[model samples]
Target: MKKIKGIIDRFEEGFAVIEIQGGTKDCPKDIFPKDTQVGDVVYITGNQVEIDKSETKKLAKEIEDLMNEVWED
Candidate 1:
């Protein structure tokens, strides 16, 4: 069981493409939870996927900080 975190980038052909820290992947709609949408954070392990609110916040903060650094220089 490999666990990873990612944000739902978009959906195509009934598959949801999740953007992770270093890559992206397409998850079948059947395995995705209802009410999930773009920008939602998710935790994936094997065939199951679910939301991780804390990890979402953490990733958002990291992105914000990176953007801040780029503009501050």
Candidate 2:
């Protein structure tokens, strides 16, 4: 297994496109939370492009809540 890190380019339906260190790979949506968006740095562990549901969901929720904070509309 290898560690892949990159920024999320796009997320739609149940999939996400990540610009990995070597290349871009399609990640499943379930791995990440419902609120994941573009430009978020993500770390994944796998031989091939795959989604880690637990890890992604946990991080996604945390990021989602943090992004929801607003000082002024």
Best by lDDT: 1
Q: Write the per-residue lDDT of candidate 1 for residues 1-73, one digit (tens) a residue.
A: 8898889999999899999886988889778888877878998898899987777778788999999999995
TM-score for each model: 0.70, 0.53
| Residue pairs in clash, model 1 | none
lDDT per residue for candidate 2 within 1-73, as digits (tens), equals 6677766888767778888766888888677655556766677765333345566667678877787874335
> Which residue pairs show backbone clashes in model 2?
none
Q: Candidate 2 deviates by what RMSD?
A: 6.7
Task: Give Cα-based local distance difference scores for all models.
Answer: 0.86, 0.69
How far is each candidate from the true structure, as Cα RMSD in Å? 2.7, 6.7
